[model samples]
Target: MPIDMSVWQGRSDPEDGNKGLRWHQKVQPADNANESGIMLLGFACDEGVSRNKGRTGAYDAPVAIRRALANLAWHHEAPVYDGGNISCDDSNLELAQYRLAEDVSRALRQRHKVIVFGGGHEVAWGSFQGIGNYLVQKQHVAGNANEAQQPPRVGIINFDAHFDLRNPPGGKQSEKGSSGTPFHQAARFCELHNWPFKYVCLGLARTSNTQALYEKADRLGVLYKDDHELVHHKMEQTLTELQRFIDQCDYLYLTIDLDVFPASVAPGVSAPAARGVPFDIVEMLLEPILKARTPKGEPKILVADLAEYNPRFDIDNQTARLAARLAWTIARAIR
Candidate 1:
């Protein structure tokens, strides 16, 4: 049997914020044919160290987020392919998540966009492989022409509270992945693959990061845009800096870990920043990004992954709903 995706009712098409849209479960490929455009690969991660490892509910996240998003089918025309979730269990922990990563990577090679829901931010590594593979293949195809090397650059923009560049911190294994280490692993993995990348990390709070991580990021030439710096400087200047990062990436993947948001806006995050990037600052900074047009004249940003939404710590699922609106902003970028 061929892979058939799962598609919940997402407004049947994007419409005016479909607040009243009711969600019903539906499997994709209603037949076994390949349909294209932005594929919403709904993956969940449960291995990233949970506050409660004994309980595997974080794995339930993608299902919840998907349910919420389906109700707000604001992106009516956005092509969505729900490649379902990998079961997170003991024996297949690595393989389950690895397959999720592998599937996402393969989809990316085929030029399908992805939005990964989460058990944790650790899934960013898989998402990175998928997007990075696309850029690297194109880079090799162009083959050393400096101008060719300049094909629209591909970048990864991470919105988080910590720098997440810890180098196994003296080779300590996470036993399983840690919520604190996805970016760290992502940066290193790309380096090992010989793929030079453009990176912009926004809302990284100093409180949660180690000084060494800052040094490492500098050594790697990664652009670290923290909340404090953006707040102190003129907002336009900050946005300009973001554009420079965008300039390097032909294919861009935006990863927004909810931890980057303040306790006020998105309190459901496991690690909220002490000083949030005021809601307005985040809006202004991302405006240009959301407005970026693609080679086909649509939005440039394609895949995205949002992690660390803990409803137990949340207020009325406000975070998910708010994220839905933000997803709308991103989908608008696509069209």
Candidate 2:
């Protein structure tokens, strides 16, 4: 895949030198052989969102979000890589998803930290597939190590407005999965592989999710906190729950759906939150977790992603800017 240089833009001032260089000037196309820095992979498909009966503009989000991120000043020494995108058409969702998994797997194999920008929440399925495959491969290579020497567990933390636990139509992949069903797919994948799925969902909206969804989440043993509880009150308690969950896992994958923020700050999503958690609060919750090391002295966070930003409905690019800032936060926070 070729890098789309067209998405990157910023002024280069010789007088100011390195101080004036933005992310666009600093980021390069990925060199898989180079075992260093962060790589950005874009999933440019909204067929999943459309199939889930949501808006159609999310397919164009990767470029729009990149345009927002490109002009931001580069403050970290970690080099950034634009690994290009995995695009999908209406007739080929499965192929695109498979290619994304392959690309993600390739990156992980080379020990590069990955930041995936999504076409929709469905991006999680591909992202999880890649990470799982890589870890499973590692286990096989270990070749019957003692239980204490086994590979660490993988945990997922998602910040979103809805549970996204809807059952796939006809109850299988042949029915075609959607943005609203990625986590469901992920949970099933975990079960099939016997991988410990320590999944935690934050910033859920009680009004947005149906009773059936809640029941499904309960049956799956998913841990979740609603928006009201986290944003309006019990903030400390929420953090405690999050900490407890994080403490039990060795490797973590963080996914943020922009809709988890208030509509005023992020209106360009398929489902905007009426009263969502503030960005600052989210930063508060993430900073320590991202910076922390596991009990085994390994970095807790392995890969992260930002999902569900639709450029078509944005106002003054507010949503895109938020996405960029969050990406910047992740880059700086990762150890």
Candidate 3:
């Protein structure tokens, strides 16, 4: 589970110096916890996918994403570090999530912006927990001794084809959660802690989600825009709503499930979208969120992740390259 140093290799052109630099030449292992910058963590687990009866090859996504990103042009000035992968051993998905949470919390504590590469959409649970833990610690350190005090609101914005709100199989409490249950679990977590569950989902396919899930989302007061509503003609209205959502939150957690894109663009996902949103539109929506800042001048996005990338079905590494491009975009937006 250590940082796979081999994947971080690519072309080199010393003659051009900085102009020719790429991520492979710039990214270093985050060996020092005190180093504050951007950190990339990998969730090398597909057990959740298996449980959800989806494709299983997403477990290898981190390495594939890194390889794809390695040769991309480095366009940012911030120090980038590879925090390594957290592998799921056997069927213990819960344990793997706990480990991921620990690493994510540690990176955040060190003031490193985290961008996790996922094994599945299930990575959301661990990533959410880590962000929640960090917020709790931060609040405690700030002398907010009263637990009853309103905690900072953290908004979750997900770009995905499915709602991922299914409960554990058979409604059994002892059953392990799957890739389709992360948001449901997150909602429960928010309720347990008495925090507002501010979630907005974009690019959801109407045919992909069931009526029960829609009802669940309504009950949870989730804000969403379907795929049909994100067209060029409706973009202005969509972005206006998105901006209003952003304005209400103190922080943001952005998660992109590659399956939200058309199968032609992201065929290597657990569930390929038949009529997905175009990459240009996704990028357009992402631009405002990435550039958004709080009233105090700090970036509103605390953490972000890319999920559901399965390389086994990829054609010409198309999906990896796209994921890499998104990662590059996120990296460049970091301030």
Output the number of the lDDT-best candidate. 3
Task: Please give the CA lDDT of all the candidate structures.
Answer: 0.64, 0.83, 0.90
Cα lDDT of model 2 overall? 0.83
Off by over 4 Å in 1: 1-33, 51-57, 73-75, 91-93, 136-153, 169-177, 293-299
RMSD of each: 4.5, 1.9, 1.5
**What TM-score fits each model?**
0.80, 0.94, 0.96
The lDDT of model 3 is 0.90
In angstroms, the error of model 1 at 27 is 9.1
What is the Å distance of residue 242 in model 2 from its true position? 0.6
lDDT digits (tens) for residues 1-335 of candidate 2: 56877889876776888887788888888854355778899999888888888887888899998999998988887778889989887547777878888888888787777899988898888898888887877777775664455545778889999888888986855437888887887778787777766788888999989999999888877889887777636778878878888888878889999999999989999888899988877887786678768777756887898889999899999999999999998887773
Q: Is candidate 1 or 3 superior in lDDT?
A: 3
Off by over 4 Å in 2: 144-152, 172-175, 295-297
Candidate 1 lDDT by residue in tens digits, 92-186: 44565577677676766666666777766666766776666656666677776554454435577888777656654345344344555666666
Model 1, global lDDT: 0.64
Report the Cα lDDT for residue 29, model 3: 89
